[model samples]
Target: MPDETVTAAEPGVGTPNVERDIEDEEEKEAEQARDVEKGGVPVATGAEEVSGGKEERDPNMISWDGPDDPLNPQNWSFGQKWAAMGIVSVFTFMSPLSSSMVAPALPQISRDLGITGDPTLSSMTLSIFVLGFAVGPLVLGPLSEIYGRVRVLQLANLFFLIFNIAGGFAQSKGQMMAFRFLSGFGGGGPIALGGGVLGDMFLPEQRGLAQALYSLGPLSGPAIGPMISGFIVQSIDWRWIFWITSIVDGVIQVLGLILLRETYAPKLLGDKVRRLKRETGNDKLYSVYDKHDRSMRAILSRGMVRPFIFLGTEPLCQIIGTYMALMYGVLYLLLTTFAELWVTEYGESSGIAGLNYLAIGAGYTAGSQIGAWLIDATYRRMKVKNNDIGLPEFRIPIILVSAPISVLGLILYGWTAQYKVFWFVPDLGVFIYGMGTLSAWLAIQTYLVDTYTLYAASAIAATALYRSLLGFAFPLFANQMYAAMGQGWANTMLAFITLIIGVPAPLVFLKYGHKLRERSSMARKSRIIR
Candidate 1:
């Protein structure tokens, strides 16, 4: 957590509202004390800035220079802010692509590696990657709180890149499983931490578009990967899929090195403290965030347990996490079983089956765009109506609409495929469910982030844990479920489950979310995680 801020050393990089000069050190000390009393922890909202005359402040404690400080990610120029987001999005895209890029190639891979007998082994080929996703977030989410976003992201991405390359060379089922799991562990960092980065850079009012785009990466990546890899598996060797994804990921990793800056306020403030002490030769200068016993062990211990605590005790976490997990499991269930629907029912080749995935890709992409536009606009309108105070519940409206649509999509695809109707009908059903799922994802993520702004990483981790595990386990049961019930009844059951869980959950949030926040032990009073 070094000084990764572009303008940390030079606090005067942005225009400050104040023009008054300090006549003495005493005057500056008084001003600093007043600023602290005002509760400045970076992301300098007007209320946190100096008001007229400074009443009191702390001389040794450091924070943003003013509401206009460019070092605050919230105050950064549009280009700088979006560039960081876009780079993270690309990283986000690469990981999930790795998760499902091997879906169509499963048959080829099974043949080459002599994986015979069990269809479950074929399911493991992709689900194992998601299992790594569940494990990594338990560690990575908390580390990002201690180390900062940029460093954790860069290192973990490199971990993904190297292991993904290894996946291409895996000669046996055991090697492939190990490689895929390890690669997923590395790739899972972005999904766990990307929400925290959004909470860092954007205010509640600005979070809708950021959350939508960020959520889109992981959602769209899995849908789009199988589409591209189908042809690669059809025309070339299946091994090329891993190598090709790795090449693209490698390029994104390099751009991250060059463009991404640190977004975590605690890390930036801590780095600033070190630089200040060196310049002033005053050992007492410290960041307020660094006041805790933040030695490596303490941070590690806290970081490791924080997400679990959030998951265990917080009602918001349980309610949101459970519903999100159901949808995610459904999404993966569709991904794992989708190609077969086309190949067996519609008499399509592997490459054409992959093209059917485009229905999903188109649906998710459209949903993301619609949700992105609707969320922020809805929040802004609600905030204004509430006299300019925003609530996390503002994100609920999108889910109310999206969740039912997802259920419909599932029912449509399931029955249509069961009836062996036109190929386009099943594809249409996939497209609908895909769109509903991504829209719901965008809204759910934004709600968690908005509710626990300071502890956003942990809040997201709580939900993501459920999402990943279900994503893994659902496929293990999919073959059994579909076999006993056929496609129509199987998907109808899924849709009913979603209707039961997904619809009521957000209504609960819209009505009682604020009370839950007030009663929850994990809720933070401050704007940053302490």
Candidate 2:
């Protein structure tokens, strides 16, 4: 949101193709505007740099100083893209892993700390980490837009690692809880920015597999963490859970330092302009955002709160943000409740109880991979059918189906778990539920990216804030819900609420989404959907 002007280079010195470069940038901007007028996708221009010279341009063209700059994430090679995605995923995976892996070890932790309370206490340890997730994105996500993704991601991971490792040293239950919250706050970075980074590197059509891989980090980490933690807790002290992960995180930090590069375009181009000006001694360098006259403090405040602002102003943001928040809450609530169900109801050991998470993990993996392929194919088909108008609404069809499956699966799991139905039956419900979650999450994430391309960071930040808050709050009340109405009825209520939000969202967006987009100043300037 801040104005970033590239100080102009030395006056009167022109490059060999200065005039040609100006004409080329003009041609590109005109072509882009025409593409917008016709609802076709504009060609992505990597970070542009201005040559050190006085250049005249068409008044109508959006002039970018230089073309073919490698500093841009968009200009990076396929290998570079994967490298960034992988590093980001590692940071993403570590935080959630720290959160949930400790679930299996919570009982031991309680025993060692000489504390005994409700099943919710154990759940608190896991869900509190997600609370940090809710809060961190508001600051981190927006800061990335201003500062770039890589720097914020790595720094936040280190911040998370410190508190997470310190959690092991906590002398009391309250201390541990505080440590978990702080760690989660730091760890929230990857979850918020991973998709935005992918959006930066991949076009909408080519993003499926990249999204699939990225999704694996969060979805699988929770499941995989418990598996490893189960064995580790059985073999040694529960403290090792934090200590071992901290060491692993150290390795990831090193890898990040080596591979992760800045991905935000404005920040990258701004740096390039600064470098060119330093070399050429010109003072007239500028970026498009420089036309605005906002102060840095004002810009930071505006940028930090933009996600919430959009959430309030945009219908799509409200619908998508609310649904995603509910889904996220449901996820943490289920994780918290399941440990008690298996251990108390079914008489499983902590190690065996932890294994049930495999159902959630498997469902998420299959759904993400399947949904990824389905998303792009679905888009292509809709494009052909619409005479290739390719509206963002084209991404909505999957939400209709995924939302119901998620609701139904929750109902099934709740009822079955309550009546002491076969363990495998509950697992089946979980599997189906996981599948629905994958589809639902993928649909919303892709939709956000589709609707808010330039501001994807802020849009997702809004979703993250609400969702993580729900994740934090839901577990606090999980015990009461199951106790008051029993699993079947409680889940039924949840399913009903989900339906109220989920079912109408896709349909409303499909029918009225463009009209909604028409009202959005941010969406109008972005390249999300043609």
Candidate 3:
């Protein structure tokens, strides 16, 4: 796949430069054709015509016509790229919004469904959705590779819309849990595939802002959802939460169909091959992704298993996955606990307490906006320092800055709330924590995308597997941990864990990322295809 940042000459009709560029590109294609022939692969010089009236293509081989093909998603215009980014980001936001939006409605749901005996079941109604986040990516990420990002994403979202609407009408606890899980499974599509979409649309150097905007969806959605859900649950009914989200998702679904285009290179090229085969009467036409003996089952199996392989074998994936999981776990923990702290500790109403979540949302907005500029500036400066060569490590400095800031915010929040200090103090702490987490998260995401490149969906899914699990489990245990250990000590422990994970990760990756990539099978595969 061509890097999205690499611009080719835009030729106008009858221009000498256009003609010369076309001639040069044709000569280059001829050279590549000759190379293919030397390698014992049958070649077709052009899709429409070839020497001696017809040409035979190697069924096992396919590739782009040199590097400047306009069909490549990377070659799309900036407006087009950003439009796709915005659409995917919206898709990503809707899922996490649904995940946490039901929090305020859980109590009502429990009463309505007669789920009073075990609180865990009520919590499960909320957290099981997150479990879907963990599971859906394992399959959906790979499916996106086999199919295309837009199709899988849109289909999964439609699946989500149906189940989520069903959840609003679920009569029993069993039905609600089933509906929520299925809805979450569908929602996971955007979370799993959004990174790969961005990877397809932007170059490494141009990815920071795009990633920052994309990252805001998942990071801020949980916070934003509850704020809206709280008012809805109080003013209307608990069921409206699901209905509202379903309605919004329906809107996003329509927009996606209208705006989203196929971005996957292999998938696009495979379709081209099929079209060419039909038009030119060539059965041998095939894409690089195709194999003479490959079956759909083999492709699905490989795609499904690759994330696990990455998680199990890649040291970078392991470390980064752990770090991202911890960050996500803490975020959810805070989300679950913040309202309780405000209501129980400070004696605020539920609606008023919910307003405090705005602190985190505001911080996310600020961090993403600021971090976008910081990441872009840092990457560009480091690239210049390294003779215009960018490294994945360029994304790590923000992590370093964020580690201490996050720790400080955690401590301030813990101790201030424990002492029943000014409300603004704890809110400020929450704000700072939000900023730190968002900054770190954006850096980690960009780093993973840059490192994994073509396999970004799988890599992100691998990490998301751990992260979403922790996101689910942490909240389940948060109240107990705070009760058992007290707010200050409990948060202190979390802060210590955050520091321990955050500090060493960037340093290790900065020093050894290249060596690690060199030893990685996935990385090698990406290089060969590129």
Candidate 4:
């Protein structure tokens, strides 16, 4: 089958002045903003386009004016690009914070709500939020593809804020459950949409640091959320947790409106095309992205099912999603169990026990920064060695280094805890594990974006589905598993599984990734796979 996806920014060789440099797209953004204010969009009327003769151009297709068009997000100024990233990171951070902040408050909530004996209901209040994570991405990720990212983000943030605040006033567990799920559904917008934004803003070679920075919110938020809340639940009412998150989310919603613009090219170009037709009285002008009959029914049908289709049909997505699921599952497993370890095994107070999560936070920070330092550098070097061409495979080599460390940490933490070793030792092992998992996770995230440049939202949604499901399911079985096997043996079993998944995943990409991409209809088109 021929490639169906068309991006206006893709370098056009046969056409004159079609090549684009997203790194420094000139000042056409100012023109685009001005045109928007005047109720239209600017055309690619560069000096080259005008001088090359308009008669030779294809007036039907709308694209950036050469590589330097400032209107392209890739060509935006460094400040603007980072500003977008920073705001999105904050959005991503708040959701995960809300997910775990209640962990420390669960006991208090159980008492207040008269569910102190029902362990299952108490856990549901915490884990049910993650279920929404799985569901929201399936719908919202695709909607962001159809609508603009900024519009969807602003709306989702507002949705999360309203429902989250409602959770603070709930009198029954059922109401709290419903409110939490809806809040998580709204919060899912950032996690689902953030990857696509990075894909839009950065090239394959430039994605490592961006991926690393964006990941900190997901990885570190869980670690930090309980640290603060342990103290809150100890001193104040459980309702404050929900109220505080809502306040922060309201602020983030405003920031998103102010800082985040439409990053998805299809949405931006589609809007521009509609404006063009209205202003010029020519209904024929359309963008390459405006292919097919894109009615609301068709868009919704395609967008809603795209994640399931990718997971079912794409082998590459299946493998990546499974690995991510296991990684995320283990992370949640630890998050659910870690406090108990400190409070019960080590005999620490609730507030003090929560502080141990800082170890994981430090490790996560180390992992993200390490990935920033290593991933793109490794990709660039490997690409140069491969005759100045790049492949998504170049992003996987760091996984080789990260996988072993993860397994080692699992063993260390499990056995040391089993033997009642020094408190610091188990914390050290947790740190190492955090560093390893986040590093590997960062590489895989960037690889997916690089591989499926156009369909990144759908691709990520596939992984997010698995990640969220595993995150929700793992905590339910964690205590039982540890009780049966003991920490040492249980961790050893987990390590073995990690080793099985982690060791070969990267090597497969290194050797056969190009071949895999050859079979993927939705992946980025490359002249040379290697």
Candidate 5:
């Protein structure tokens, strides 16, 4: 691969200019090494800085010390890379766990808090957390770009821990809602930034498995939470749900401090520039990020707003975001309604109904593990056929298979429960739905990361905003939708909608995705794939 560097030359000027004489490869490598020892690569031979009416060129422009620098997160050891992935995965798990942990306890909480007349308010307590999820990434994702990933992530986790612990002490519906929202706000950090961590640590070729492993946290947490909380809410006070999760989060925070390291290359190089300026008394030491004269506020404002811009302008983000949102919405809808389906239809206790969630968890795990292997293998096979060049479109084919499975699962789940048939039949449908949802999730996430390598966090944050909103709003109307339409038809409605939205997405990307990406401003700025 060609060196991924930021030269002062205009875009597309430095590489593959056949009309210009190519420099000697060995001599160029040797010169780059000497430049690294001097603190940074020069801006370019004739590059001039024009800040504040100054016309002099600054020779000290910082970047990675050649492609193999150990400081670069991409070059980190396998043990270190996996360690970072694991820590972020743990952080990712806690938020989704907390989101649905309160589901089984909602009735008890409603009764204890005297939430009478309207069950909507009670459901609000559970769904309001996802509302926070929708809003947090706009600020947190950009903050990661500016401050660094480890710092932002650890601080956000601490924020989540504090608010979540406070939730245990709530005496009123208002207090509980406030605490849950704040906790969720903090929880959004890992979801927004975790993709960027994977993008930083692994090449596109190796990201499939890492993404699949990381995905298990968010996908399985919602399924697993209700299972554990069901028993806890039965035997223990409902308040212990918050208390126990907070304690687990505290432990994860400590692990984060020990294991997580700064992965954003710009932030790392910026720090290096600051240190060199202090040690050598040279104010001209700068980085490519410093080429512009924007203030911190301006930079943050732009960063915070970029996700919305991508959503509006980029077809890839729009299509994937819509599909992921539908999948997420359905997942939460199932989480909210599955237990009720069992209790009301099958005459099972809350605890027994909650056990059905384990089927969903099992499907998620199996699907993620299998999808990981399939994605990596398929990409490798395609790369070999294409002369070792990989495209983001290689990630889309699996979703074509998974989407239909999800639609089938939804249909089966709805009809089986509506008829009040054998209990295990509905469970089997739930398991299938879980597997299908997770497989599609793995493909979408991996595609986004590969397509928007440098801006992976922002792209994911944009997609996540749509997803969180759908998750928050879908359950609010779920009971009414199911009551009016009946379980069989209601879920069939969802299945059809899923088919309409989900089926075309992968096929479109498979055929025209590269063309769409070539025209995207975000994709052009990323300049990582080509």
Candidate 6:
């Protein structure tokens, strides 16, 4: 997490300070020129010879710093790594917190802004924020690849912070809608970038806990935010929703400036090359990704465009994206409706209504933590069974188990909430629902990461677009939906639909997913054959 850019060299070479060794500088330059003539980057031969004795060396492997360089993200101290993970999780938490914090304040916002008293309109306020989350990942996810994760992520957060504050002053519904959408666009960067950053920082085995911790941000933030927002709305005014969250986001941004550093290997190496060239006049030193033929404009365009391309063509992305989108939409729907259900049915106060979110939060925490360890263990076991070859299908078994849990949760929450059943009944149902959702989500996300690897950002972005849009759209219609069919039958309808789509999805994917992946041009290109 320190602000140092790691420059890769041969396996064991210490990067010489270009400031010293003037006598050898000219000789080194001539040697590098000869290497270039032979179409190779000038590497220190002595460094290679020194490192070769200890381990297997791949001369063609692209590296950042030496194999064991402390500057590499892989070599960072555990404390530094955890701190970085915490920073990203905090960043990830703010957007969703903003998205749902206003749930308890909907009536206040509706009254003061002169909006119609329709629950659908009120839900739109929160859902539209989710809509921005959907749109943002499509572009931001890809842009992170071209510019590196930290820069795009921080810039997007600033954009979110700006619109969030602006939402505080909106006098009309139109302004509120516009500000919410824009703020969401900025806020969504963390959702798209969080996993990719972990991929950059940690190896596969150590990544689970970090990812599980990060997963809590999006899931728990919404649950927790309204706890405070409910109190604020009852005591203060709805305007403070924007003002208070913006202040919190500002603090997060300041901490990020201090702690978040670049992790992308290409960017780090590119910076090193530029610095080295300035110091030693070695203009030819460059990364494999660096090519004179490709302009930054082209790179940016390609990075931005690839996710959509993959989304359109890759069946793996499509199936995973669809399921994940449904899960996210349901989450927002629950957040939007929890206050109404509790306050209306159980005659709870606003603060008490908000507290029900803890059920969902508990479910999420348990699912993610348990799911993390289970996923890794499953993946490792599958790897062992497959002659030490890891298949994407290695992740499918847990997803299969989670799918039915999701259906059951829907049934429990819907039927219990329909009757004036015990308050704890609905809470337990929601907790079950939350666990199932998170479990499915963790499996889908880790599968996507494992399957796509380098293009994980784009794949996630493609999913983000639909998922966020659905998150927005679901709440907008929840009131209409429940009114049309009533809560029990309505959610039963949803459960049936979920079964139709989700149930067979995992089974099909688990059995034939490898072959399906083989047909994907992107997967083929990445050489991610199962």
Best by lDDT: 5
lDDT of 4 by residue, 324-349 (tens): 99888888778777877888888988
CA deviation > 4 Å runs, candidate 2: 1-69, 118-122, 293-296, 527-530
**Global CA lDDT computed for model 5:** 0.82
Query: TM-score of every model?
Result: 0.89, 0.85, 0.87, 0.88, 0.89, 0.86
Q: What ranking emerges by lDDT with the best candidate at the front?
A: 5, 3, 1, 4, 6, 2
Off by over 4 Å in 5: 1-58
Clashing pairs in 6: 8-65
Q: Model 1: which residue pairs collide?
A: 32-57, 32-58, 33-56, 33-57, 33-58, 34-56, 34-57
Q: Write the per-residue lDDT of candidate 3 for residues 1-530, one digit (tens) a residue.
A: 22112122356655466333433332333334243323334354434245687666654456666555677787888888888999999999999988888776777888999989776677788888888999998778767766788899999999899999999899999999899899989989999999988988788888889998999989899988878887888789889999999998899899999999999866787888888888888787676545322355655665676677788889999999998899888888787777768878999866777788898899888889888889889999998998777888899898889878888888888999999999999888888988988989899999888887756777899999999999888888776788888778888899999999899988898888889977875554444121
The candidate 3 region of ten consecutive residues with least summed lDDT is 1-10
lDDT at residue 211 of model 2 (Cα atoms): 76
lDDT of 2 by residue, 157-261 (tens): 999999988998988889988999999999988988898898878777677678777877766787678877877887887899999999999999999999988
* Clash pairs (backbone) in predicted model 4: 20-67, 21-67, 26-68
Tens digit per residue, CA lDDT, model 1, 1-530:
01111111234656332211211211322223233334463222112346585433457768877667777788888898899999888888889988998988888899999887778888899999999998888788768767899999998899999999999999999999999999999999998878878878887778878877788788888898898998999899999999999888888888999999999877898898899999999998877565445566655565566677677778888888888898888888888988887888789888999998899889988898898888888988998898787778888898899999989988999999999998899889989998888888888888887777656776787778888999999888777789899999999988998899889988888888878876764443322221
